[model samples]
Target: MLSGSPTQGMFSNSRIGNSESPNSGASSSFTQPIIDMSENDETELLSITWNQDYHCFAAGTNHGFRIYNCKPCRETFRRDLKVGGFKIVEMLFHCNILALVGAVANSHYPPNKVLIWDDYQSRSICEFTFRSEVRGVKLRHDRIAVVLEHKIYVYSFTDLKLLHQIETLANPRGLCCLSHHSNTFVLVCPGLNKGQVRVEHFGLNVTKLISAHDSQIACFTLTLDGLLLATASITGTLIRIFNTMDGTQLQEVRRGADRAEINSIAFSPNVQWLAASSDKGTVHVFSLRVRVSGEDSLTQPNVAQGPALFHQNSSTSLDPLISTNTGANPNSTFSFMRDMGSWDGKSAHGSETFLLRLLPKYFSSEWSFAQFRLPQSTRLIVAFGSENDVIIVGMNGSFYRCSFDIVHGGDMMQKEYVRFIT
Candidate 1:
């Protein structure tokens, strides 16, 4: 989700200072807009999300859960948790509906439970309790997907009635993503296999699993409409995209040749661009329309980034896994990846795609475009504030706004960033 406007507001008792300072190295074509609202404090942000309407963004802190209007950037509404910490939060697009879970069980809301909040009333309308701890939550218009360590429970958003239950491997983080498109309600998650990705078409009662990687599946994301799905492995060097409706391999890109931890994947609203951030302190952007021969977008064998920071170059193909050109393919997790030999295959249009080998921007020594580079730690959650701007929040309670301007083909592009929170 993106931040909508500058004058949008947030209301909190905490005194906030607002001023715009010019950023250095901004493109001459457009001035970089930077908003530094406040400095860092004792509060630790456990979770943050923006409503679909993009009117406000919510953050969970030791102080409590609070919402701030976008344009004005002041804390708006807040509900402090008496005992527990809110770890995962999902908001229905622009709706007053919110789904919340605690990182640790508290007397008010247990760890193994999910609380549904109606911000209009400033209280939890209802809650769903489970036997195991709830790892993640995603809300669509009419459905709610709750992730468990080893299973997933889909429920009717209206009544919270049991809809479907899916069993996965031991999923500790409870990762899952829902399509942002209004017409599509698709869900994707880690499958039973170590490197498999499962896609569920909620309206059609159908599911497809793709052999995404040979290593453990680290993270994956779905485009706003759910037509495209991107998956990365624990090795974190490569990323593959698959069609959600049919299990056909659409495209693949490399994040780096060597192993790095992938943090998140995002698609532009137009679906023309994809961006990924890893612990290597870099964010790689790729064009979906282009294909690379003998390489994925970020994968260039033995090649290092412009800054001389990255090392390693290995690529994989999407063969060996059955494709469903005519009908749904088999989704079996019985075969281990190592036993399946080489999955390397060439793309049909690999030779036609242009190459983009720009050095990645460093957030730290490994700078991520979305995170604050602190001396000790950096954890960033990225969201689009507009078509060309990215809003990032650090775990240490910092917010950053990055804006890009009119593109000059090739590597000539202007960009600027503002510190919204510290």
Candidate 2:
């Protein structure tokens, strides 16, 4: 790893512009070494993603893709895709498999075309054209899931062979997630019904659906092994977890009674914790308790019962919890949480157990055991870097590294920030 310290300001992708003069001096924001591309300087960054091992990360910019090594904090190499420019791209681990989608801002490339590249050769190996514009692309070892507005096409990575096609409800965000292991294949997407999620098991050729929310599903994620799934709706106040086997609702957590758009959901590698971020500028951490044999894990309130839930019978269904959208409440985040923190099951548990089932166990009203408020921004995405560290990036052109210490209840505080690009 490089010995130099990381400050604010100094990062950008490939460019063709005049270099910064030495007299220009240091930037007010904490960035790195100064840079200057050539004259056509359109190096604005659009998206960023890390490889499976986190050894390297790729930043998609208007000019091309910039690959950076994490530990040493240096540029490994720059892959020029300047012809039309790749506004967004996905990398398959540390391998050379790269996926590209043209941005609306670029006129040179077709928005409906996908260019699959191999960094090893610095060239695109496959060119795929679709009827409608592509919203997102997910790369895997054996298969690739290309997300369109209302449909998803799965293709074999080796041959680009069409394997299956799924139609979804209005999925404008192109929200989808999959397992990390090459051997375990699980694909999740919004279901045909609003607020529902459809799970696809490609290896077994089986599928299941879970009614996860009442409003439209905003985003969702699958655990490393693909057995557990977490979902959030457009309403944004709540999140739910479901079993892929029988589509049983395992847990439900409230972001706040007030409506907020969910930005992302992630599961820790250890499966000991779950994290979430929203448009509200808050990143939350929830501790998970592992389930024991035959115990009804859903009502535990904290431990991650999903590992055990997957082992349990898939045919069993707990009394379903129908959701209602009362819209955003001024005191929704606070008042609802206060009530949840103290309400006991005795007062709510009964024949229907409606109120009890709705209690905060799975969806703890105070879902966030630890939370961090970020600078107000239009977009935010978060992922666990290590058990105690978090990596967050916002549309404001800033990247953050935060630390969560369990010894102190894990209240995350920003440890580092880099103003990558403006």
Candidate 3:
């Protein structure tokens, strides 16, 4: 969902001005104008969403929508229907198929309809009409999930057959996510109670309900393999990770002590790290302590075991006295003392533990190791890139690529910047 208020009448069918190419450093211009320019200075940017693979993104505007490649930051193509504005334009990876929902501006493209557009033919192939306005639309290879105010419907993409329906709380932001893994079908949506999440595991024919937080859920995401789930609440100070297989709370990471609106949360491709963007103009990345079942040990050498050790049915606990094996290192006389000092590998050691114990839990919470600062006023979304880099896209038509130091985490170094729209 967008992080800022929607602007009306700010966009026109006018042709956008050209800018320098990101790679060639030469001036580049779009094709001849399809419609005459208006007096407006800026186009209404309704929403910006990355494709499933994060290699490209679609920008929904009043005129229509435009697709752009993310790496070199170049516009691939645009369609100026001139009919109305689009509130949501979700691309199906790099394919020509797109799921589009209209803004409340024109009757030609109503807000209560989801149009399946095949950009190759430049026309909508089929449409789904609803009684209430459509809040969100997610597309998979074999399914199409639609989100409304209080209900979610999953449909078979091949024949548009209804497969499942779920009742949820008041979800105006259309909070829902799907796992894109080829071997798994996992769907997550708001539960009947606030701060709750309902996970639907289709492959296993199991449903797990997890109470994620005390307040309303703001944002959540799932790993590509559909094994781990990350969630953030309205408080926005803490982000929690859960094991989707057994509904176990694996770990919790703090974004900050001050409450702020979390715009997005993303897990690294390797599942060794996580990143979150907040309204406070900072993007935070944290090293994950929990490991996946089949993940490469080289990805996170420090972590000893995966979440399998902390299953709900298991007797293991995070307490050092129960989980630590002091006898494993018998050669050292102070091995027990050393293990007691370090509860988790990332926790405080020696005298620092005494001071941390006196303070509130917020003060001793696990904080982000790396951060990138941006303009607080600009609404942005974040995604992981190659190596330790991150891709930030803003509603103001700005794109930034920054890399973080994995060994010595701190501020991220800017690698590239571009004004995608002017």
lDDT at 215, model 2: 80
| Cα RMSD, each candidate | 16.5, 12.1, 11.7
**lDDT of prediction 3:** 0.74
lDDT, residue 317, model 2: 48
Quote the RMSD, in angstroms, for model 2.
12.1
Candidate 2 residue lDDT tens string, 165-263: 889987778888877664457899989998889998776677888888778888888876576788888888777777665687765566766778888
Instruction: Indicate the worst ten consecutive residues by lDDT in candidate 1.
Output: 19-28
- Using lDDT as the measure, the top candidate is 3
Q: Please identify which of the two predictions, 1 or 2, would achieve the higher lDDT against the true structure.
A: 2
Cα lDDT tens digits for candidate 1, 151-253 = 8887665444566778897888687888755555678988999888889877566788888889888888876556568888889877777767667776566
Question: TM-score: which candidate is best?
Answer: 3
Q: Model 3 segments beyond 4 Å from truth?
A: 1-41, 293-359
lDDT of 3 by residue, 1-422 (tens): 21121211221322222212111111112122223235354677889998887888999988777889888889887766555778999988777778888889846777887776655544445567777888999988778888999998887665555778889999998999998866668899999999999999876678889999999999999887666899999999999988777787877788988889999999988676788988888999987766543444224332224343232244554321112332322222233445575555555466454655787777556678788998545778899988698999988888999999877778999898998887
Each model's number of backbone clashes? 25, 18, 0
TM-score of each: 0.67, 0.74, 0.79
Which lDDT values do the candidates have, in the order given?
Answer: 0.56, 0.63, 0.74
